[model samples]
Every structure is written in C-alpha cells, then in structure tokens.
Target chain A: MSTWTSDAAALRSTWFLRGVRAAFSLPGLILVSSFIGFAALAKDAGVTMAQAAFMTGTVWALPSMVVLVGAIGSGAALPAAMFAVTLSAIRLMPMVMALAPEMRTGKTRQCVLYLLAHFVAVTSWVLAMERLKRVPPPMRTTYYAGLGGTLVTTNVIVVTVVYAVADALPSAVSAALLMLTPMYFLTSLWGSARERAGHVAMVLGLVLGPVFHIVLPQIDLLVAGLIGGTVAYGLQLWRRKVRAA
Target chain B: MFILVAGFAATDIWRFLGVYLGGKLSEDSDLLVLVRTMATALVAAVIGNLIVFPGGALAHTSLDLRIAAAALGFVGYLVSGKRMVVGIATAESLLLAGLYLNF
Candidate 1:
C-alpha cells in the first residue's frame, strides 16, 4: 500500500510537469514581455533591480505597482498608494472565483490551489479558463501550476535582462519594451471579453479617461473606472430586469 | 519601490481572501455573474486608461497610431476566433511597426 501511494504521488508530479508545459506555451510570452516592460519602468523610475524583482515576486501585479511607484515618486501618501493598488486588484475577485472551481478538489489540493492562485495573472488565467475544458479535471490544477510557475521564473529573468541592459540600450527600445506590458494586457482583455456590457464598459473607459484626464487629471482613472464600471453594471442589471419582466 | 512593494502586498491580501471565500461558492450563481461583470468592467477601465491617457513612452506616439494598432489587433483577435495569443501579437506587432516608422 505504501509503495502504491508513492507511485501515485510520483505520477501526480509527472502529470503536473506536463500540465505546466501546456499552460506555459503561449502564456509565457505574455509574462516575459510584461517583465521586460516592468524592468524598463523600474529603470526609468530609479527603482533598484532587487526592488523590481521583489515587487514582481510579491505584488505580481504590474499596473498597480506602476501606479504605486508613480504615486510614491510624486509624494502621494502611502495610504493613497495602498488604496489605489487595492482598487486595481479588485478585478482579481472574479478571476479567483472562476479559477477556484477548477483548482480546488480535496483539502490537500485546496492548499496547493491557494498557492497557485498567487501566480494567477491576466494571461494564464484566461488561457487556463479557455483551455481547461480540454484537460482532465485533476490535471487542470497541475497545468495551471506549471504555467504560472514558468511565468514567475520568466518574470525574474526578463527583469534581470532589462536591468542589465538598461543603460546600454537605446531609449526608444526601452520605451517600446515598456509599452508591451500594458499593450499585451489591454489587448488580451479586449480580445477575451464575451459580454456586451463588458465591451461597453471598455468603450466608456476609453472615452472617459482622456476627457477626464484633461479636465480632472488627479482622478481620471479612478473616477472613470468607477463611473464606467458602475454604469455598465447598472445597465446589465436593468437589462436583466427587463428580460425577466 | 518600498511603497510599491507594500502596496502590492496589500493587494495580495485580497487574493488570500478570495481563496478562503472561493472554497464555499457555486460557480454559476447570480452573485458570480455580478462579480464577473464588475471585474470585467474594472479591467476594461484600466485598458481604456492605458490607451487613452497613457503616461511614459506611449505618450510620445500619436493617438491615431495607438488607436489604429489597438483596433487592428482587436479585430484580428475577433477574426481569429478569439485566440488571445493571436490578438496580443497582432496588436503589439502593429504598434511596434508604427513606432518604428514614426521614429
């Protein structure tokens, strides 16, 4: 019985390796590119290399980190930076909801799942959700683990490369690399939206940010996001009510 | 950097909260839908902010180029039947090419 249990554990680990490979495929590109961008941002912002890597490992949310750094650089209060980052991470709530069902099985699996959730990024979450149906249930967790693990490792590597080449590289190249982070994120989310309200929310945000930035630069993103998301949610609720009626 | 790290750590507190809460929910409830839509909207808002009022290097490029690249990439993603990799590569490639030309 002990030998059988050991064999089962080994098999699970091996399967996890395969799952990681499958999950890592295209999703890895997104993480790697984003890390390069993060590196550039760190360099331009005067953040140390260790600090950047630490941020990636800890915060793991690029945009929010950027906002936090920007806020600090501009001497914004620490509480404000915390609030902004927390607000930025609000999107992860649903992603966790969606992914949790796929990851959690038994108690031990739940522990692993919780650790795996830390690695969830925009790219891997989408890929995992979309591709999970093709995979067996038990292996889904392993695959997600693999994909996210590769991304975390790649993030460190990319950031290191960017830091190494920061002074040597041309400004244009650094700039282009940095843009890839947001570009990849925006494009990925834009591509994956399935609901009309989601699309509308995006459009509203796109239109409102610039308008608000020109008029109320201090809180354009925060205000636009609140207004846009609230409006979309309200519209969706109304539509549902009408349909029910 | 210190603040950003602390800020991120704070953000992650929510992820941990999610794990605890997620262990006890149905995947297809109305509440879930509400959560999904709210999250989607926030993501949309962030994307919009990036494109429309970019800071840093993206601010150097023409708004037209950014719009065109994003549109082209989005359409490509749709045309390619919602393949995320295809969409991301398409948009990034277009923007890079456009940036190169302008420079």
Candidate 2:
C-alpha cells in the first residue's frame, strides 16, 4: 500500500512538472517575446510599468490587454474601453469551452475547472489542446494548472522588466518581436485545425479582415469573423450533403 | 484599479461561462462546432489586422514588407512540417533584414 501511494504521488508530480516544463518550449518563449512588445506598447501609451504588469496578470489575455492599451492610448472613456476589451475577449469563450472538457474528469470539481478556465487564452489554450491528449484524464487539471500558473507568473515578470527598459529598444526590433505573436497564431491555427471548415474560416477571415477594416473600421473584426465563420460552416454543411448524396 | 476591474470582468466572465456550460455541452455538438469556428475566425481576423494594419512600432514598417514577411513565414512553416519556431524565425529574420536593408 505504501508503494502504491508513493507511485501515485510520483505520477502526479511528473505530470505537473511536465506542464511547467512546457512553459520553456518554443510556444512559451514566443508568448514571452510577444509580451516584450506589449510592454513597449504600454510604455508608449504612457502606462506605468506597475499598471502594465497588473494588466498582464489580471487580464491574462494578450489581445484583450492590447485592446485595453489601445483604448487607453486613445483616451477612450471607461465604458467604451471595457466594451472593446470584452469584445476581444469573447473569442476566449469557445476556447475555454473546448478545453474545459479536455481537462475535466468525472472527479474534477466545477470550481477547479472554473479556476483553470481563467488561463484559457490563445497560447495556453493552444498548448493545452495540443498536449492534453498525452495526459491522463485524472491528471489533466493538475497539468493545466502548472502550465497556466507558470505562464502567468513568467509573463508578469517579463512585462515588468521589459517595460522598464523599453525606451532603449529600437522600433524595428520591437516591431519584429511584436510580429511574432500573429505569426505564431496563424501557423498554429493552420497546423492544428481539425477540419476543412476551420481552414476555410481562417482564409476568409484573413481576406475579409482588411476589407472590413476599410468599410467599417470600428466593428470590422466582429463582422469579418461572423461572416467568414458562417460561410465556412455553410460550405461545410454543403460538402457533407454532397458526400452523402 | 480600473484595469483590474475592467480587465478581469471583460475577460474572465466568458471563461467562467465556458466552464459552466462546458460541463453540459457535448464536444461534437452543432452549437460547439459553430462557436469553435467563429472563435477561430475571430482570432484569424485579429491576426490579419495585426499583420496588415499594425499599430505602435509595427506601424513603422511598410505594409508590403509586413505582408511579404508573413507570407514567407507561412510558407516556411508549411515546409518545415508546421514547426512554429521555424515560422517565427523566418518572419522575424525577413522583417529585420528588410528594415536594415531599407527594402
């Protein structure tokens, strides 16, 4: 019985450490580098380093943080900035929905899932979805907690340090670093897509994003996503019908 | 304080909702599929906007250079068996090279 108990404890630690270790991988490094750019942007927007670090910790979503910074830079009112950030964060809903089930087991508590859900932004979501299949069901939550906790802590530090020294970095270098986030997103989404509909949605969104930006600059992202995704879904349904026929 | 309140509410509410609803929903449900696709598209739109019409420092670079770098990076990603690091290295290198050479 003692041996069995020890084995279980060892297994748990191994899984949790595995998640922590993943925070040093390419995706994790990319996430940290993106925050370097965010720090620079925040500094340029006149946000204090403390506020930037606070946002990074509390907001946890890079895009939402970006939206908040943009809103602040433009001197947008509180309600408007909140709304914009909320809009950008709506994308996290599906991500959490998709991921929650993956990490949940029959014994997992709802509160535990709720706590873990706070870390369901782009990079964590992508990393968890890609790696969770390798984790046993009972240990998935622990693994995710390790990953999320490390990512949040590490990024907060990155923001703090980078914000303090941002003035010294060249515009070109910071721009190149900032560009890494989107490049990582595009490539990962393309690589991990489960179906043709996802590919279609991505391509349509990419094409329509710039077009809608010109036509309706304010709500361009939302409109492009709605139209692109719906059209992709419709095409998927049609293709299924054709195959069945 | 404002960032704390607004940022937390704006982002975490959906996550809480997802946790609540994820328990009841099936993975392959039609609603889930639609939501997933919409989310993916939304993210894609964000990526497109960032690359094509970037703000802050990225705005200093010309649009053509940014687009070319992204395209080449994507090609490199595909050719490298979808390795993310490879894509990032290609794009960052191309972008910096363009900036330095005044291309």
- Report the C-alpha displacement of residue B77, candidate 2, in angstroms: 0.9
State the lDDT of candidate 1 residue by residue for A1-245, as single tens digits: 56545534556677567656764566666667777877877766777788778777777766666666555555566666676567667666667767877766554456776688787767777777887765556666776777778777777777887788877876556556756655666666666566777777777766776776678666555666677777877788899899999
Question: For each candidate, what's the DockQ?
Answer: 0.48, 0.63
The reply for model 1, stretches above 4 Å from the true place, is A1-10, A107-110, A130-143, B1-6, B26-38, B55-57, B99-103
Every candidate's CA RMSD: 4.1, 3.3
How many steric clashes between backbone atoms does each model show? 2, 0
Name the best candidate (by DockQ): 2
For model 2, report DockQ.
0.63
Interface RMSD of each: 2.9, 2.6
Q: List TM-scores of chain B, every candidate.
A: 0.76, 0.83
Q: Per-residue lDDT tens digits of candidate 2, residues A131-167?
A: 8877777888999999999999999999999887766
Clashing pairs in 2: none
